[model samples]
Target: MRIAHTCANCGHDLSRLCALIDPVYGLPIVVCPRCREAVVRTSIPVRTRARQARRLVVSLAMLAFSVLLTTGFAGAVIGLSSVVFEQWVRAQRNSAAPWTHEGFVVAAAVWAGLALTAGVWTGAMLAHWRWWLVLPAWVAMLFGLIFFVEVQQVVEFIAQGEEIDVLALATGVVQGHSGTSRVLIASLVPFGLGYAVGLPIGAFTRRSAARRMWRRRRRIRLHRRNA
Candidate 1:
């Protein structure tokens, strides 16, 4: 019905106990698993600092990879976007149709937000991060790609000053829509696929690092004992 326990580290007395069975360790901490601190069961804040840290590192790495891969593989599109889209935005801002310019700016902002969100989501998903985080990340990645690849194409066309070749550019992207839609769709596949692909890589990397950390810690602990 009841068990006696104390903080493994601090040895604080706990009046009540929880019913948790860590078959490996075989104990519940009055020292809460939350804060990894000794508590009287008052408010053991569930500190996910370690998880969050791992997720953060993975998020950053994924973001880098996502951007690099997307940019590298789709250099033309990305480059065109940088050169074409921004210019269009500026032009729109100055033009009589200023609202169009605002749209362009809004579109760019959306893309940026999506890229970041995607990076973070893919990262966390791979890290086996919480559900609350996973969905948002996926959305961000998808949206980011839509804006980055598609909208960029749109700007390029506006800048080209050439007669629009409906067939030349509209390969896989814009089926019903125009050339830009095609570009967006092209990127969207990988952008979504990235989450799936990025997950395994992220998980693998995180696991590898954690394993190394565990080994190093064990070695040090052993060394201290021998000494």
Candidate 2:
């Protein structure tokens, strides 16, 4: 399916114009025969540009919503798992049992799973974007949240009249003092990996579905013609 090109000024169909270099501008343009308006090769109609802008805004909104939703879900799962693990530990207090980091492992797994799911959903929803671009943006958004938290901590420390060590602050952020920070750091790789894997899957699935529908429509048209 292709969009029909028309003159921006006079709305004359310019689809059939012979590609020519405009003498005045020395640029490739299609001269609309009816209005004699030269539509530059690089010029997009206002309507098409507006539509693209709307799509971009929608894609960003969807991406943000997905991230927030995933973050909340992951937090809830980790909190519940932690509570359950604490209860189990109390129950086993009578016996001489070794302490296990099972709760941390479970939380990490939950974060990774949620991140992967979010990546897949985002890739599918914004399949028009290049995977390379999408992956970096997605990872940056995750890390950006962590950075914001770190900055807040730094500000709090300053407010308390504590001397700040840049190296220590950086190390702490990297080591993750908070659960949210840890989850974001741990899921960084998984989120990017999932998005890289999902892009091709999503694109292929969308294309195949479109192709099938096109074939079906063609077949129906042929049947009608025969009838």
Candidate 3:
């Protein structure tokens, strides 16, 4: 039997990765220390698609938690601002009555672009620059969030005794959306582009870092030889 001794988190080669006995399962599992915490939190190994699916679930849960946290924070800010400025909430509701779909499209594009950049960067850092691991997971997460919101909207619409405009329900969460097909394209394209760009940029970053490390090591070795 081939012994699978690879990391369950970052897919770092287990040659240098450490091994530990899983207390819960009472089994010896080899994983990198960098991702040891994640492995411990989630006993599912990364060696199989089954485990990857579990990781995706965990990631979805985390994304939901983050969204809740952000929503709460935003709510607090709005509440405080309303209290301080008395007419703040009224002004906000009244001021944006004529927002165009194009404006919303631009906003979505900008938001998605920034989110993708930050998420990919953080994932790369956490996964030790493994773009392969990072990109797929990030894409899954984005899709998961989109799916969750769409489902919620559909549920709410059904509860309201309204016929679900499936297309509009999917993309209507974006403020001022009229559920037009164009709005869907505008909202989705940026996220698609973001996902597309993440891999190449991550690859470039890894290559650049490797080159810099090589040069630094070469300089140190030369100096040592001269000394």
Candidate 4:
């Protein structure tokens, strides 16, 4: 008969994370404040498979919601931004890579949704070393995608009435790609590294804060005893 309290959103250790209520459920549910995905108690007696299934459901839902919000918001923003940069964006379309096209907004939304869903599912199910699966996949996919596009771009540049040599263009793309991959690796590495780096940071912060509160309480007791 033991259940620990937690946030309803992020699954972050609610010992330091804030709690929110599920308005419909009328329960003191915890949730990720930013994404609003539920944070539930995971130490249930359910089988490992059951837990994985549950995580998949929640993660997929989160991804769907993310797509809705991102597309809806981005559409609004793009509409507004179009007034300022539509010409520039349209001008670049011929030279831009296919992935960078304006018309692929829906596809962008779908891809983002898939990535978020996969990442969140991996995070919840593989709370341990499993998080690495998602980050590495994301990094690998990003690079693979960019490499494919760069190759196509060079081909297109050559096909058109352009003076750029295809081989030289490809060589430049490879060099440019090296830098982009490094940036992605750097950005995504933190999430994979978070388990090790985050634990000590979170523990020390929580412990130090608790100690100060304990001292304050003890001082109040001492003052009463003296009086």
lDDT of 1 at 4: 35
**How well is each residue in 1-227 modelled by candidate 4, as lDDT tens digits?**
22344444444455444334445654434555657666543334455468679879997997888556534433332233232244334546677754566554544344334434444433443344444465665555555555676677767877896787668766776675553334345434333443344445545665786798797566445434433
TM-score, predicted candidate 2 vs. hidden true structure: 0.40
What TM-score should be assigned to candidate 1?
0.29
For all candidates, what are the clash counts? Answer: 4, 0, 0, 9
Point out where model 4 deviates above 4 Å. 1-133, 161-171, 193-227
Lowest summed lDDT window (length 10), candidate 2: 76-85
lDDT of each: 0.51, 0.63, 0.48, 0.50
lDDT of 2 at 156: 95
RMSD (Cα, Å) for all candidates, in order, is 15.1, 12.2, 16.3, 18.3
- Superposition TM-score, candidate 4 onto the true structure: 0.27
Select the stronger candidate by TM-score from 1 and 3: 1
Model 1 CA lDDT for position 9:
57
Q: Could you give candidate 3's per-residue lDDT for residues 1-227 as a string of tens digits?
A: 11344555676556444344556664445556666533322222444467568879997997787666534433332233223233323345566532333444444444445544545444433435454664455444444454665688778878999887767655554432223223333323443454455556656777897998797566445434433
Question: TM-score of model 3 relative to the true fold?
Answer: 0.27
lDDT tens per residue, model 2, 2-71: 2336787898877655455556666556777888876764434686578679979997997789667756
lDDT value, residue 113 of candidate 2 = 73
Pairwise lDDT winner, candidates 2 and 3: 2
Candidate 1 global CA lDDT score: 0.51
Q: Candidate 3: where are CA atoms >4 Å away?
A: 1-107, 115-132, 139-189
> Who wins the lDDT comparison?
2
Q: TM-scores across all candidates?
A: 0.29, 0.40, 0.27, 0.27
What is the clash tally of candidate 1?
A: 4
